[model samples]
Target: MPSSSASPPPPPWLQPPFLLPGFKPELEPKIEPMNCPSGQLEPFVTRDTLLFTPPNPNTVPDEVENAFPEHLRLAHHLGASSNDHRSVISAPVVEVPAGPSDIVGSRKRKARSAEMVRASIVDTPDRLYFRGLVRRTRMTYDSLRYLLLTDDHGRGEAGLSDEITRRRKARSDLTAGALMGNRDLWLNRDSRIIGCIPGIRVGDVFFYRMELVVIGLHGLIQAGIDFVTAGRSTSGEPIATSIVVSGGYEDDDDKGAVLIYTGQGGRERNVAQQRSDQKLHGGNLALERSMNYGIEIRVIRGIKCNKSPSGMVYFYDGLYKITDCWMDLGKSGFKVYKYKLLRIKDQDEMGSEMFKLANELKQNPSGGRSVGHICLDISTGKENVPVSLFNDVDNDKDPLCFEYIAHSIFPQQTSQGAGSMGNGCDCTMNCSMGCYCALKNGGCFPYDENGTLLRGKPLIYECGTGCKCPLTCPNRVSQKGISYELEVFRSIETGWGVRSFDVIRAGTFVCEFSGITVTKQEAEQLSDDGCLVYPGKFPARWIEWGDISDASPDYVPAGFPSTPDLSFSIDVSRARNVGCYLSHCRSPNVFAQFVLFDHMPYPRVMIFAMENIPPLRELSIDYGVGDGYA
Candidate 1:
């Protein structure tokens, strides 16, 4: 080291923090000059007005006879007075020795205190990165002034004005001068002086500006530069993560379903309480709009253990479709909005699965081609027969003739007339205005719109031959015949049944149970043979001849003179269609609807998928079998 006569100048990093521009020199209290034998010296002083005594304990001076002037109090405090220099040379002193236990105990306490202080410091990666900037970076005082105290509010590059406010609120004795006087802002609380600036008098206005700069720099060091940065999803979409979901939903599924519970309201809540609150109150409107417009949200698990980071900060479960939203009583008795979300498969995952499924289907045992009229061997080893078989029903014998049904029932209602019913349009055979059959039936055509059905709806009528529409009309869902690739196979429990070759989405039209037209009386006679199928007749009265349709003019009952109700059954025992092999199931995959369009005396039975059916799954329908049949 160089000669000790010259004290080393303060570190370059420390000088910039003290000399920032927002500090005002006039605000600092003046250090009054006092006369000294050596020379007059101006020095820093404490605001407290306590009298300073000389080094010698034995020499007592009368207070009234030898008191120093008021201006000399600061000099005495700094121990820089000329009299203090002489007193140090002439004073006789005695040394006191500490016991071994006392010295050891004091050393132990200091070590323990240092450990405690170090443990309390925030030592995250971001914090260390910021602290490095304050300690390593060198800049001129003037240049650093613009960076730290450009504004009076201490709103600087690091955005740390809030920390200054917090510190001021916590300590009453902390003053701006004391903060500026501190030189080591990088040290943890374990240091001799904990804060960056230290050792100045309280209520000094100049150091107040200096305090702001110190606080701004300290906050930057502790929280890091990215503390205020927003989070984003892995897909690079900006995500809103403020809303939370607790309980599961009614229809949530294991693979991809998500149900969100927007938290309770009345008091300030993290999420929206009511559905309307998503629009009117708080920042929830952004989340609500995002979900409503099909934007993916960042779902954070409410439970802390499950909140472990998956990507940036939270696990990105996946993008979801907001299928439904409703209100219900929350845990707090306030109404809350519950949103139902369906998880969308990632494009990469979906593509891989599709390719695999397609390859499996191509290598099917039946060679992936239709054998005559039947789509055979959907399940390679599952079916007893190598291929499906059926007795071909003659095309002309179908009771609901596409050529005559419309003409027979609505003799006056031509395609040219107002040809609309239900939600259907009045399109003729050409269907230039779009098929009336597809429009009227809520767009449930299997060939279009992915064949999704609106559950529990009324019967849908297809275009008839009387209409000018071509055979290619979209309305001819069932009329176009079974479009789904199906295999007929014998079931272990329920005789012969039908299964699809590929996955079928819910609401897809499966097939119609088509056969010969017959009266209810005729169907009842053949019921014992297990040949006749009743589409919609109530199970309780199916056996009673009195309840059976007597539409035949010659078959009038003894008491009934008026025409009976128009319910007819089909005789499919001989002329078997593919649907005749469909087995009955308590929890059926397919549901039958009695559809009546043109005035054929009996209603045509139509079948639709009730739920999603995977490839090679057996198709079943509810046979309307009540307790008696069970």
Candidate 2:
């Protein structure tokens, strides 16, 4: 039997094709830092002409006073010397109890705080492992070894050849052990040898590096150090040997470090021998350390690997320790090797906090309506219900309608809701780019032409003053009552447009669904498969609508008295459609949102409206639809 690794190339279904386009030029925004406010005053000391001299204890007060001029003489009996004779005196202090040695104690407290801060900022072993891995992969092997041995970044020629030779010998020994058994007689003398190596101790650290060579999809060659240990002979002669062949190695310089003993013992004999054995173990006594260790590999540069087709080789350089090895004889022509190591802490945990924060933000709604709550829909008076009529009656009892409304009204409340909602008007006749008004009172009426209304016209529209209305308003009261308008002349070029309105305010609605007539059985069937039935004939419609024929045998229409088995019929004029005939631009305005009437079990897709809808701009949903990221 052939090895599983020797199986034929993976099917196309297992691999996706690459569709490459030209790269988009980056748009850099210029940002300048604001300067500080002006007119800030500088700190300085005031200049004055005041000097005081303490009187000598032996001298008389009158003689001391006569030493100065009359203007500076002290005022006595008559107090007629001069107005400047008064001296400005400093305040005298009264003794108070010292409060708990504040000065020295505070200094000590600050010192302790600084020490604690330093300890908190110290790097963990895991962090060191990850940083070492990154450095090894980004630098050459010689450079890495130099950094490790000499604590420097540059490579040195000293001991380079010897190190490389030792590595080669170790590799050969490991490969030979893997292929056959250990040749050392001292270790292989017993029947329980099982291809064991002798002379290596149980606790030594060694570096191992090897290239994996895969041959004919089955054979593999691995060369690396094995185990490093401290062992002793029956005569109590201490020995420190590295099992360089298997997957470990011992450093000669690491002798007599520290030994962590865990085995049981009662009788004591040779203290000197025991001390020698302890010296052989090395390293600060870390008893029962985890079996896993660290590994680092030099980055293999200038190698290009293709992800498509067969006979491809992918190469990546990194560090990991080999935890297990197996050679299954049952699986002919194949060998399996398993390696495990501690995950690089820095790289793995970089974005974890951000992801957690985002999740929390999503769960807790902050301000107004969440973007997910809004829903927009277009309707006609015939098969489709008018917007006013749709809003007048609450379809809260219908689970589908209820969820839709909830999403439209409080989009953030539910995890699933359309991000944007608005009205669309069909305005291809009046404006080539598209008009924002709807037909009212037999005429079209226009308002501010800022294009905000025109941009959202694909969603909803209202007639402006310039509409082609046949009847004129009789009075202000009559005009107020006739606020609703009819949409006409939707353009394929303009795509699906939306009208900007301040109806419920942004983020107000959380849920909304386009309500269409469907049989109960049909809805149930759709529910089972997790699909939506949308009305309309356009191939690019967001949802597919089903007629009575698509309904099940037990189908029943909503609000109908009799159960009639009628043929399936779809309303062409009443269905709301998103026009996709226009060419797509990098930036587009109109978007779409869809509700699955049937499938509640699967993920749903939602759409949003762009800020501007260019002429012939293609409408699209960004949820893994069409060419992703294209």
TM-score of 2: 0.15
What does candidate 2's lDDT look like per residue over 121-203, in tens digits? 13444334332222222122212222123211111112232222233322221221111111110111111111111111111
| The best candidate in terms of lDDT | 1
Q: Write the per-residue lDDT of candidate 1 for residues 319-408, one digit (tens) a residue.
A: 345566565565555555455555555422222133234336535634433332333332243322233432133222222222211011
Badly placed stretches (over 4 Å) of model 2 are: 1-489, 492-606, 610-630
* Model 1 error, position 255 (Å): 19
TM-score top scorer? 1
Query: Candidate 1: deviation at residue 434, Å?
Result: 11
lDDT of each: 0.33, 0.19
Error of 1 at 49 (Å): 58
lDDT of 2 at 15: 24
In candidate 1 the C-alpha lDDT for residue 525 amounts to 65
